[model samples]
Target: MSIYVGNLSYQVTDEDLKQAFAEYGKVKSVQLPTDRETGRPRGFAFVEMETEEQETAAIEALDGAEWMGRDLKVNKAKPREERSPRGSWGGGGRSGGGRGDRRY
Candidate 1:
């Protein structure tokens, strides 16, 4: 459903991405994330297709192909890892400061 596209031109828009993938299959969605402070294109995007076959076709055709003056790095998007709170540990097998329950 999701494909990660890297090394994209900042000038690219969501519609442009959709159109590019349209030849492979129906594009469900396209997301081009931007910088928090600048709101500019982040030079990468996540494209969603209607099916896995369409996704695989897009990956096979677009991966390493030259487009918009850069080679594309297209692949299946991996699920994001769960994140812990800013200062809290998620109990990933590490000692808590190694201080025997001592408090600062």
Candidate 2:
């Protein structure tokens, strides 16, 4: 079961998240999205549990629970949107940096 947790403190680590939810059941994984450049937490994360019961319990118990002085936002994760292939920009094959023929 997948769960969405938001409003996380930037200092929270994956182990902190795991320990928080482990009180209810086994956690499969905890993913905290971070800045690709700075490696800082993005204030949100995805937690996967072993069963729906555990997921529901986590959501109910932690949905508004305070963590690191902030109330966490917990819910079932929504399906992620599909992404286009890399470099396949919808604007007719233009690369990200610039158009070759256009004079800057």
Candidate 3:
């Protein structure tokens, strides 16, 4: 399971996040995304722990806890939603077709 850590200071690093959660259990991984255009931390991160129990413990301990000069927002990460492929816009919204578009 994963935990979403928000309201993070942009300076927070991978090691810093791992260490903060280490008191609860083993941290499997941390994914800190960056802005595509500016290449800066996005102010949040997703952290995976070795087990669901560990994740829960971390969530309970860290949620609303202050760290690095900010109140941390921690919770179970929501499942990622699937998106339509770029430029394809997915199906079924067009109102009608002109006479020239008739298949017959």
lDDT of 3 by residue, 15-102 (tens): 9999999999999999999999998899999999999999999999999999999999999999999987799965577557556777
Kindly list the per-residue Cα lDDT of model 2 for residues 1-104, writing each as its tens digit: 59999999999999999999999799999999999999999999999999999999999999999989999999999999998889965785656655566775
Q: After superposition, how far is residue 66 of candidate 2 from its true place, in Å?
A: 1.2
Residue range 58-100, candidate 1, lDDT tens digits: 9999999999999999999999899867987567786766658
Q: Candidate 2 versus the native: TM-score?
A: 0.80
| Span of ten consecutive residues with least summed lDDT in model 3 | 89-98
- lDDT of predicted model 2: 0.93
Off by over 4 Å in 3: 89-104
Q: Return the top candidate by TM-score.
A: 3
Model 1 TM-score relative to the real fold: 0.81
